[model samples]
Structures are given as C-alpha cells and as structure tokens.
Target: AYMNEEAVGKAIRRSGVPREELFITTKLWVQDASYEGAKQAFETSLRKLGLDYLDLYLIHQPFGDVHGAWRAMEELYKAGRIKAIGVSNFAPDRLMDFLVQHEVKPAVNQVETHPFHQQVAEQQFMVDNGVQIESWGPFAEGKNDLFHNELLQGIGAKYQKSVAQVVLRWLTQRGVVAIPKSVKPERMAENFNSLDFKLSPEDLAAIATLDTKASLFFDHRDPNMVKWISERKIHD
Candidate 1:
C-alpha cells in the first residue's frame, strides 16, 4: 500500500511518528510464499522499510505455498519479530482450513467489504473463530457511485459528516476494521474523524439493507480468476 521504500521512508520521516504509536503492516507477496522465501521476504520488507519489526504482517493472498509461509510466519511471531500475523483475501473456507491445521491462528482477515458487499456471513464466521475482520476496499473503490449514494448522504446529514465518514463509522461500529485510502490530507482527516460520531441503530439497519451479498470485484472461487492471479509474479 505504501508502494515502495521511498514512499515508506518519506512517510516515516515526515510524520515523525513513533514506532510504537504506528500500526505498521506489510505483506508477504504471493511469489514469496514458500517456507524459505517467506522468511527471506520478511527480512527484505523490514530492511526496505528500515524497521526492526512490524506491528502486523500478512500473507498477501491465499495462493502459492501458504501452509509453508504460515509456518514461517508462526515462527516469526513466536520469536517476537511480528506482533500479529494474518492472511488477506482468504475466503471463509480457506480461513477455516488454515485455522484447523495451524497452532497459531490468523489474527486478522483482510477482505473486500463495504455497504454494498457487507460480507455478513464471513464476518460472523471470523467472529466465531476469534479472528478480526479487516476491510480493504472499505469504500468499494467508488463503485456504484458510493460517494453520491442518497442513503449514505442522508445518514451523513444527520451527523454533519461526509458520505465517506458515514461509511467508515458504520464499519467500525459493526466491529470491522477499515482501511480507507486517500492521497489528500484533508480527506485523510475526514476519515480519521469518522469515529467522532456514532450511528444510530436504525441508521445502521438501513445501511445493512444495501448489501447485495456479492462482490463487485472478481470471485476468488472462479478458476479463471485463480489462473490469472497465479500466473502473474510480483517481481517477475
């Protein structure tokens, strides 16, 4: 998400933010999912970001040698190098399978979630398994003209908040962690201020009705999607 070493370095320098106060997260790319490769990748990421340890590290996807990667991550966690280890884009079934086989369960599951694609079932499953659900495309990447949605706007009017803020607050109120991205500082502040207002139970229920229960993006279960993602190498 930070893109590269330069971006990460710039952020670290400009923010002057303390390491302990920042919840830094990085991921092991699918290309580096093998057991040894995972270890190497972790070290590479640390060096690139100029950090001794990460607050959280995640398997970028459920592809490649995930079992081997998880084993390596578990070792890193036990060694106190990573505060938390998780998996991203893992479906409920894959998550359950991984949980059943491993002694160290995943701390978080990052997935595509928003008002449109609420992932209600998956969220409940994660709750049942004691895993935190984090939303990656929390704003749905602006799909369905999310910014101008009447329902979200109406809710924002009640709290004098922006549509984006309303959506973020809704997610957090439901106990889901949201990662909303913005290049502008003002927009970032708006998102950060979302926690200032609490949505009413009726408003939350209204937002819940917007769920289509289907991903606006690609389906991981589709064989074609799997092949497309698998053939592309992060470094190649």
Candidate 2:
C-alpha cells in the first residue's frame, strides 16, 4: 500500500470493514532492516494504522540486514502482533537461504508474476518449499502492452472477461495469490470477479506459452537497481 499513513487510516475508518474479514499487509522498508529498527518500524506502522495486529507483514526487499529484520519479524509473529510473515522480491536462492537459516519459515514469497513473466521454476520452488506464491505485478504494469496482447485477449473473450481478469484468474488457478491494483471501483470489481470463472487445461497451456521467463521490470540482481534502492530511506 506504499506505506502512506493517512491513506491507511482513512481506508480502515471509512470502510468499517471488520479486521478479520480484511487482510491488511505492509512491508518493512530497507532502511529499517536492523533488529531494533525492524521492531520500532513495526510498532510505528501499527500505531499509524491504529491496529492491534497485522494480518500480514513482509520484508519489502532482499537487501540490507534481512536476517536481523527477519529475527524481529519472527518474534513479532510469535507475540501475535503479526498473524503471518513473508518476504517480497526475493529470488529463489535468497528465499531458500532465508528459509533454511531461520527458525520460522516464511508463509509467503511475493514476486513479479504474470503471463509474460510466469516464473515457472520460481513458483515450483516456492510450492515445493511450502511457501505461498503471491504476484506483485499480475498485469505486468502494462509493460509490453500486456493489456492488448492477443493471447490474453483471446483467452478473456472465451469467458467474457477482460485481459486483466484473465491474468488474475490464471495466476489464482495455479495457486498463486494476486494483488491487482486499481483506483477505480469498477476495475476492482472486475479483478475480484475472476474467481467466478475457471480456465480449462487447454486454455492454461495456451497462456503458459506466453511466458518469457524474464521480468518486465528492473532486475533485482542489477547493480544499478541495488544502488538506487540502497540510497532511499523510509521514515519511522
């Protein structure tokens, strides 16, 4: 949710949504990757959101003192402040490393997953490791003109769905969780409606062929990306 305090406060208050019915998730920014810093960041996020506990907490990136931050997250989970803890943007190797070294296994591993960048091997690894796969860019953020792609559009036409809906449904059908963002209520409804229909095995295979096995966005392993991320700081 981009860590905007005011937006979160208003969302919680205006919706009047029961906490249990809602799955609230927030990330521990890279700047707060230390042991104590992670603890303080968690408390501050809770205070800002006016919540007693979080539904899901995630380490935003794979960089920095991740082990230290994860230790704090593990404690928070044990303390009942966080129901589930996970990591985001972690490659398979790093995710497995964290899982092996830590006492508590991560409940989820969120990454960029779409028809264009299906991440087949990574998804299989997460599945084998018993970690839930969540997609950050299910629609590829319109990269490579994903919305207008003939393959996805054709698949959607079969079920009277939009390209975005088809993409979301395809991911969920593979047991992958998707977080599709849209400011418009109609678009939000469209994304949610994906659960109403099911894709056939043939259709799934057709969509699978669209996988390029690469990220449409910046690579996490790139030195430039690392430098850019390391320079930023998120306030407590």
Candidate 3:
C-alpha cells in the first residue's frame, strides 16, 4: 500500500522495502495552487500514492496563488501531513521573494537542470539560503544532442559509464540531488549507479564548461512562457 501508489507501485511492492523506510515525494500542479485547491489536490495525490505522509511535497510551478499555497503548506508542515515542503522551477528572484516572506524556508528547489543548462548561479543562491537543489530534467530530455556531447562522451568513457550516468554523477558530486525519470527498471538501476563512482575535480570542471546558459525546455524567466503555462492545466 503506502508505497504502491501507481503503476510503479506494483514494482515497489515487489521490492520488499518497508513503507516507513522509504522517502516518498510527489508534486502539486499549478492548477491546484490555490488554498482550497491545494488542500483537495494533495489529498487526491495522497490517495493515488497510498501514502500516509509525503516525505516531500512541492509546488509544480512558481505561478498562481503561490503565496497562499505556501501558507497552506506551512500549515500542513506544522500539522505533520507533509514532512517537507518545496518549490519547482522557481528562479532566484521568485525564490528570494518567497524565502524572505515565508516563515518556514523551503527544504528544496527543483529546477530544469543539466550540463547544457546548468543553473550554477541559482544553485548557489539556493545554497546561500540552505535549500537543496534538485534537478528536474536531469538528462535534458535528450535535447541538444546530450547523448552525443563529445566532452560528456569522453568523460563517460573514462569512467566506463554512459553519458547519462556521467551527467547524474556530476550532479551528485556537486551536492545536487537528482531525480532522473525512466520507466524501465534497468535504466532506474543505471541511474542510481551514479553513487558508486566519484567524478574527479578535473572531470567536474570539464563538464562545467559545457553550460550554454539556455534551457531546452520553457524558460521560467520568460513572461510569455509563464503566461502560457499559467493559463493551461498542468498537462493541458
């Protein structure tokens, strides 16, 4: 139950891991960003996940009644319904505004990050605020020939790891927590294998040079993109 929340639940149920020992996480979409909406949406996700307590709960986007939602999140935190609260896709200015205004600091900040669009400045800002940086599109969604990046390929060859694995290791080495999505169990095992090998400082520096300062996905800094997303439902 608690762990078997979706199709993935069946696999977790088979893994024999106890529910209490697992750190469960799920997101609250922008459509449900309001006070009442957040309350109702969370319950639905809880029901879907069969989770009694979410290890982490995040605002899917920085748009909408975020301040109001944050208040409700603080209330939830105090009541122990959610163990931790955070925001996803929030840039420095937006994060700063909320951090300065909210009573409870967010434990994490999930962002669109990869070697191509590495958000070093934002990550640094989050670090300054004691917020853990989590990567959303850790592999860049295969955009910009991420698999063919010569630098990454060379580094991967050196470690006997795939470019994807090398990228995940680079993030972990930078103290960033990554949640790479892959519906395949073999790929999931490969993703988790990053913890085994450490990236050298030289390798870290080389990968750092791959940053192009642009997002393959929507740019949160763009007002038009924000407006478009704000108007649409989460998957609409």
Candidate 4:
C-alpha cells in the first residue's frame, strides 16, 4: 500500500511490454480495511497504477475489518476487477478463521521468509491449506549478514553461484515464492538466474540447518506491533 504505484505504472508504460505479459499486484492498506473503504482503495490503487484490472489484490494486513475487506475483494474478483485476491502477514490462526469465514479462499500468504528466519512450518501450513507461500524478505533485509553467511557461501561455491542465488534457489526448491529485491541490473539478472539450477538434496538439507525459525524482524503477533501497525495511516 505504501509502494510507489505511479512510478511502477510509468516504468511499465515505457517498457514496451504487453500488459498480458506482466502481472501487477497491490494491496488494501489498514486504513481502508473495510467494505466500502476496500472498494475505494482498490480503485485508488488501480488509478495510481494506471490499470483497468489488477492481477492480484491483497489485504495488506490481518488487522482492521478484515472480513469486510475480504467481502469487498470477493465482489471485485467476481466482477473481474481483480483476477486473484489474498492477504499478507496473516498467521495460521487468523488465516484459518478467515478461510472458514469467507467463501473465496486466499490464493497466497506473503510473509517474512528466508534462510535465517525460515518459515518451514508456516510454508507447510499454507501448503496444506492450499495457499501459495510467498516470501517477502527472502534475504532477511540483510540482517545477520545473510550475504556473507558462510553456509550459504559454501553452498554457492558448490554450484558456482553467488550467495544470493543460492538463497533464492533454496527457497525455490522448497516451493516458496521468494521476492528477493535488488536495485542493480546485474543483481536482478543474478536473482533471475537462480532458477537455472536445482539445489541437491544434501544442499537443501544443509540449508535447512540455517533456519532459526524466528523472525529477525518484529513479531507480527505482538500486541505492540499490531497496535503500531494499525495506528499508521497512509491515506488522507
């Protein structure tokens, strides 16, 4: 919701790429986590992105009137305004409740996932529930020196890949969609190249040892974090 959709739209318009070849996704912010608010937020996001329809639209968080927001999203999906609708930062309990409460199930659950804070159980939970697990912080935002991690570096050495590529490949091997952000063209290309090779079973097992199973970032279930997140407003 805080993303610069206008800039993304501008870039897309100038890229000479067809709309069908690109998949655009945006989310409804906490302030607009209500039935009518979600409708307006969807339109606002669409206008900002200069798009007539969205490939994926997610409720940014599990807070606020989530059910109401889901209702709005369901209506939009049914109307073909959004091809898919899902959520982010939703824990298993919240996600289960939402699933039971709603008619349309979530297509994805984007959460903090990486080698350091490997969401193995979380990913399996989403998998069992038929939701795709998408990793937001696949590198842990450089926390704990993920770039120079010896385990990752050793694994990369085996495949003649960079540490970043190794990490991305590991996530891929686990069937989680890792969105490892990079600014440099070379880095982006390297990230894309991770799909070329597969991590061996031994390499995968070794990477699994790097998992701490705890988020390097703040806990989403913490009361203080929830309060802080819910208090923030991006809209006028």
What C-alpha lDDT do the candidate models reach, one value each? Answer: 0.92, 0.91, 0.86, 0.90
lDDT tens digits by residue: candidate 1, 119-153: 99999999999999999999999999999999999
The true-versus-predicted C-alpha distance at residue 137 of model 3, in Å, is 0.8
Which of candidates 2 and 3 reaches a greater TM-score?
2
Q: What digit string (tens of lDDT, one per residue) describes model 3 on residues 1-236?
A: 12234755565577789988888888777778988878887787777766667889999889889988888888988999999999988889989999899999899999988998899998999999999999988999899889999999999998899999999999988888988888899999988887789889899899889898888887776899988877876432
Best by TM-score, which number?
4
Query: Which runs of model 4 end up more than 4 angstroms from their true locations?
Result: none
| Best-performing candidate as measured by lDDT | 1
Error of 1 at 161 (Å): 1.2
Q: Candidate 2: deviation at residue 14, Å?
A: 2.1
* lDDT by residue (tens digit), candidate 2, 117-142: 99889989998999999999898999
Clashes of each: 0, 0, 0, 0
- Per-candidate TM-scores read 0.96, 0.96, 0.91, 0.98
For model 2, the superposed segments whose C-alpha errors exceed 4 Å read: none
lDDT of 1: 0.92
Tell me how far the alpha carbon of residue 4 in candidate 2 is from the true structure, in angstroms, after superposition: 1.5
